[model samples]
Target: MRLALTFLRINVMNELQYRANFFLQVLESVVALATGLIVLSLIFAQTDALDGWTRPQLLAVLGVFTMVGGVIKFAIEPNMARIMSDIREGTFDYVLTKPVDSQLFVSVRQFRLWQLTDVIVGAAVVVWAVVTSDGSEQGSVTGGGVALGFFVSLFAGSLMIYCVWLILTTGAFWFVRMEMLEELFTGLYRAGQYPVGIYPGWLRAALTFLIPIGFAVTVPSEALTGRLTWSRLALAVGFVVLLMAVTRTVWSWGVRNYSGASA
Candidate 1:
């Protein structure tokens, strides 16, 4: 833990060199939020509700989505990409020689401290649009519930996304160009902006199983909005375990495969 924090501190010190980039990051986050909110407004303008989610409820969900997506895209995803690149280019040899667990080393390698603004802004949105009002009677979540469920959802979503990335990038043995798939993952995360229930049956199933993205954003949002059920909670937990196992297996296999490829 101390070593990780030390590395994180080093990353921060390195990032301090480019303070201008942090301003650009803040600007980019606001622009993205405005675009998302505008689109949501336009959609709600056409319909009273989307998938049983009212305006405030939808706002809360978007808040959750933005926060999770920010963390994943800004730090988690980029670090995973760095891992895959290192693996393919022999830089990972440095990691292999280290005494630390390679996966842990790669997983938490980078810390883009500035991108945390998205989290703050997203939380603010949830606070303003959902938690501030007393709508307990309206079947929405209590503020306490939203806060608890938000962290739970964020944890589950981030773990699941990291595991998925591990599984995806671990395939770099034969497919050295798998970095392109991050583009697809980015698009899928964007799709999480809306309620997954609005998707078609097949699409929803794919999001739940094949990609398991809904858990990353929607299910947690559901919990925040008081729409979660035991079944969903169980599934989220189950998938987290399942994904962890699968990603580990794939990463191990990839290591062996890469060894063979190199030979």
Candidate 2:
């Protein structure tokens, strides 16, 4: 934790030197949030609900999506993504020489501090949605439940994201052109913004079993809205543990396969 804080502070000091970038980040976040909220609002305008979900309920889910998505774009996605290029070009050896775990080092080596703007904006949207749609109107969620669900979902979502990246980048073990796989992951991650129930049954099932996104966004928000089932929460936790194990196994196999351009 200390190391993360130290890295965060250093990043803050560095960013302060370039104030212009801060405003640019805020502007970008505003545009992104506006576009997301507008489209959802327009869709709800056509109908009272989408798949048993009202406007505020869906809006809450959207807020979680943005918060998680921003974190990925800002750091997790960008850092882990460079793995393939680094391996192909022989630049990853430097990371091997460092004292930290190679996986952790690679996963969070950089901070796109600007993306925190999206996190702030997402929080605002979620709070407003909750307040505006109190009681059964928003499905009878308590403050305690929402807090608990937020952390639970954050952990599950982050774990699934890490696993997906690990598996995709691990492809560099056998092939050089792995960006295609990463592109596919990006598209699916975007689609995760909507409730899984919003999609067809097959696609929803795929997201739950194949990709593990079911635990990431939907289940977390469901907890906040008093809509989550105990069975689903258990399943989410179990899925996160299982996927983390699988990702570790694959990562070890990939490292063993790596020759590092030196016989």
Candidate 3:
């Protein structure tokens, strides 16, 4: 924890040197949020709901999507991209020489401070959605229960995403130029802005099982909107554990295959 905090402090201090980036980040976040709202408005204008999800519920989904995207851009994506690049350039040998756990060290080495704007904005949107939504519409779910479930699921979902990303990035050991995977992941992640149920059965299965955006965005939204069931929550938790185990194994195997710059 101390090592991670020190790295975070360093990143914050370094990024603080360029204050203008903060404004640019805020602008980008606003534009993205505005575009999302416009699309949401058009969807609701045609019908009262989409696949049984009300406007506010869908708003919750959007908020979670934005928040998770912020997290990825802020920390996970930057670090993973750096890892892949370092691997490709054979500079990853330096990382292996460090005393700390390589995975933990790599994970904490990069952080985009300004990217947190989306996280704050998304949280505000989630609050607005929760407040505006009718109690009966939410099945009379209690705030405490929803909060507990939402937070737990959100943590689990984010960790699952991190695991999946690392597992994919580990492929850099053999496929050195895996940068294109980032664009592919982002394109797939956009689908999480809406309920997975609205997609075709095969697409839904792909999202739920293959990419995991369904669990990352939709599951947390379900908890917030009172649509999450205990069984589903358990399934998400179990999947996260499995993903973490798989990621660890993949990372270990990849590290073993790394020949380093000296080699």
Candidate 4:
């Protein structure tokens, strides 16, 4: 943990040198937030509720989506890119020789400090949604339980996402040209911006179990809105453990394969 924080501090200092990136990041976040709000406005204009989610509830979901997407863009996406590039350029040898765990080294080696604005914006959106949703009979965000659930679910969801990325990037050990794998995850993640309940049963199941964006975005938002069920919470916890185990197994296999080839 100390080493990871050291790397993060170094990355932040380095990124500070490129001041123009700050403005560009802010612009990008504003545009993304605006686009989401416009879409929400259009959808709510047509109907007052979506899959039993009121406007404020959906906004909370969007907030979770934005925050999770920011985290991925900030950490996971950059590292995945680096993993692919290292493989392609034969620089992975240097990573393997490092004293640190190779996966940890690769994952935290890069940071985009500006992307944190999305997290701040997303948190603000969630707070606003919760405050404005006070009068609602259903989907009301209240009490310590809902807040605690939101944070817990958010952490578990993030681990699930990290595992997914680890599994995807682990494939690069064999398939060197798997740079497009992140794009595939991005495409799937877009589906989580809205309520998963509106999708077909099969699609919902796929989002819940197959891809896990539903658990990452929807389930956490549901927690905030006081709609999360114990069964769903159990499922989320189960998925986190399952995916973490699978990712570790796959990463070990990839490392062994890489070591053998290098020797």
Name the candidate that leads on lDDT. Answer: 3
Top candidate by TM-score: 3
lDDT of each: 0.79, 0.77, 0.88, 0.86
- TM-score ranking from best to worst? 3, 4, 1, 2
Estimate TM-scores for all models. Answer: 0.92, 0.88, 0.95, 0.94
lDDT of 4 by residue, 70-138 (tens): 888888788889889998899999998889888778888877889888888888899989888843544
Q: Which ten residues in a row have the lowest lDDT in candidate 4?
A: 134-143
RMSD to truth, every model:
2.3, 2.8, 2.1, 2.0
Kindly list the per-residue Cα lDDT of model 2 for residues 210-257, writing each as its tens digit. 776666778877876668766666778888888888888888777777
TM-score between model 4 and native: 0.94
| Model 1 Cα shift for residue 243 (angstroms) | 1.2
Stronger candidate by lDDT (1 vs 4): 4
Candidate 1 lDDT tens digits, 67-145: 8877886578778788778877889778778888777787778888888888888888877766553353333444576
